[model samples]
Target: MRPAILAILIGLLAAVAPVAGGATQRASVSVVADLIERAAPGDEIRVPPGVYEGNLVISKPIVLDGNGAAVFDGLGKATVIEVIADGVTIRGCTIRGSGEDVTGEPSAIRVTAANATIDSNTIEDALFGIDLQEAPNAVIRNNTITSKDLDAGRRGDGIRLWWSHGCTVEGNTIRGSRDMVFWYSEDLRITRNTVADSRYGLHFMYSHNTVLEGNDLYDNSVGIYLMYSNGITLRGNRMRNNRGASGYGIGLKDCDDITITGNALLANRVGVYLDNSPSSIGSTGLFESNMIAFNEVGLLATPNTHDNVFTRNAFIENEQPAATHGRGRLVSNTFARDGAGNYWSDYAGFDLDGDGFGDVAYEPRSLFGAMLANEPNLRLFVHSPAQQAIEFTARALPELRPEPTLVDSSPLALPPTIELAIVDSGIGGARMGVLAVALLSAAFGLVAAMGSDRRLTAQHTGGGA
Candidate 1:
């Protein structure tokens, strides 16, 4: 009897397959495209509440408003929407079901024209969320994007700008995607964005004069990576728990004229990693007033990385506050600027003159750190007995002490206040609220236990009565 039932169900599913396939084919007709053709170039087309299946192309200036209740389904085909005209606005739509093939670089929306606005859209199950190619002065804001259900390495970028200069990307949340990348783009203003569960929250290459401010990035391979970019300003961003393979809160390579200030780099493998930055001769980098805290290595720089000034930053409770990438020391980098230096939690120096600066210079000369620099594998034994023994031996014997990696002549006597406001994506708030509730419950339980004990004592010794 069970075999007969299974056979009947299989036959029914087989019979429905062709009918379902025909429905999908019929839904592939571009309904929005017909509406676009009928409307004038400058007219506003407000799509009503429904699922409009098929791909769309906007080739003239117009406002395509979905009224917050419309969805544009791609039928698992190529890009869902393509904008080829300047001054186009696409907002308040749900875009999903793009083709999963990475070879075609399928995106929910691909804009190739200048001054387009893509805002307040939810893009899901897309291989690539939004791609702006040579689309200068574009605005991308308040969008939530999640990629296809592929492995992290196979997923395409959440948002990508290729040669799209003078763009503004703000208030977007991206998750489970490859990267939010900018390539060969200049004068970009990226702010207030939250990106997590991605490869790189922000990746920039050859993009100059960009400002990345007030963004929150966590649980990514790397928070932000800038390569071959110049005149980039990174300020007031919170990068936390980015502990992937190359887990740097901020990684810089061959970049020049970079300013990193007032940011919090917390709980990453390396808070900041630098490789030959200030690559151009006579160009300098500045890192100031930032919080580098609770990482395996607070700052890790290659031996040849030079001309970077670190000042007014706070390095707090890292396993290794600073370390070289390889065998050499970080003597080329400046730890102090204009008689002011950063705050190190491990600094033993004191300020006798009440000047808020340490009297002695702060130098990190750890033999274990030097060994870890030469052989990064040695970090496996970090915080173990072996590491303690090595550090103790170096401290006991002056000759065994390695040269200081970097010196701060005027180390701060106290940690400076760093002001940063990151937009939380509610996960942090929920976790914190749970912790508060747990704490309160524990306290209440303890109080009840104590009261019960008091009552029992009163029955036995009359003290509580």
Candidate 2:
């Protein structure tokens, strides 16, 4: 009886199946949406190497595999793939946008499930390359994300995480996005990514216990921004060329217990800008074993920031040197060519002994630096001949220089664990010197203009006639 029933059901299916143009089989589905609609949990959908134009929604726990370099084009309206189920894998595809949207968040791919992997894809032209919301234990790795619009207020990010935890974001190249990594989520590992031409390379707000390592953050308005975050480790990163009028390589505000080590900060308007407002009380941050070089100012610590340590770090050739805003301690750090001194290109202290370290203490903080702190425009006089003469005199006379806290008579030892001197030697120092010269030239131009105006007025008056 059961065999007869199965045979009757098969006969009914065959009779109902539609055929076209003398064919017996039904027409195969052409759109990816149709394929996804037909997919079941634990099934696999193999996409061919062609442009599939539509929004794809994966509601079942299935694998979507691109067989041969497939491309998913989102026709400039909606997300390419929106995953709403756990244990989904989307791999080996090129996903392109659905252009920018002012009213909503558009993404090339969005994963809102657990144990999902989005990998080895090229995503572009979306408001966000990948948006991970409320997804835990997800891996978004080895993707290239690019966007054309990088305007300050309009452009979107490469990867945006909201309320997601235990995610690993690794080995991605994110370019032309406003904020490459926007982390409101926590417990993330962001490693070995190259983020450039963005507004803020890595932005962490209200996120904690995140690790960012071995990343190259360059050409952004601000390389890394940490706000109200804690227990974050930023290690072995290179932040350079982040030069806008108000840009910083790294900006920390109201953050605590953050460790920054083994990073190179080069040619930024401000290498690290720390603001401790009244709201930020008892914030303890540590900056250790980083090469802060060739910046307009090595470290700008504002008022209300307290109990932070600048230890064992190299501050080299900064035009205005270090500016202290609030009370902070600088301990056992190298400031000059001598032992424990930074490799300041402006160091004039003599090495009286045969030892490599200078005999006299090299005071990195200067009255000129303090003056420039009050009047930042006076930074134009940083490398002026007159300024050089003053610095020389200050170095020759101990009282002339900023009073030394103490001198390290012994030879300076490089930090054993941290490779702070990773940058090419000539490039960093030369860049700082060039900036100093340019600033001086501007100052001289202003002086000449004032003098010319005064002489013209005197000539017109003709001795009070």
Clashes of each: 0, 8
lDDT string, candidate 1, 1-465, tens digits: 999999999888767754664322223326678778888988998876667778888998999998777788998999999999999999899999999987889999999999999999999999999999999999999999999989888999999999999999999999999999999999999999999999999999899999999999999999999999999999899999999989999999999999999999999999999999989999999999999999999999988889999999999999999988888878788999999999999999899999999999999899999887778788789879999999899999999999998999999999999878864545657888999999999999888877787767767787555
TM-score of every prediction relative to native = 0.87, 0.74
All candidates: CA RMSD in angstroms? 5.8, 13.9
Candidate 2 structure quality by residue, lDDT tens digits, 1-465:
999999999787766643322223323224666777788888888875566677778888888887536778777876778999999998888888665675667788988889889888888887778888898889988888887464755777788888888899888889888786545678899888888888888888889899989888888888888888888889998889898655788888888788887888889989988776213455557676788888987877674455665555666777755666533323332233223433444555676764555566545656566555467687677667877777667767877656433233332333224563234435558888999999999999888877687777887899679
Badly placed stretches (over 4 Å) of model 1 are 1-29, 423-465
* Overall local distance difference test of candidate 1: 0.92
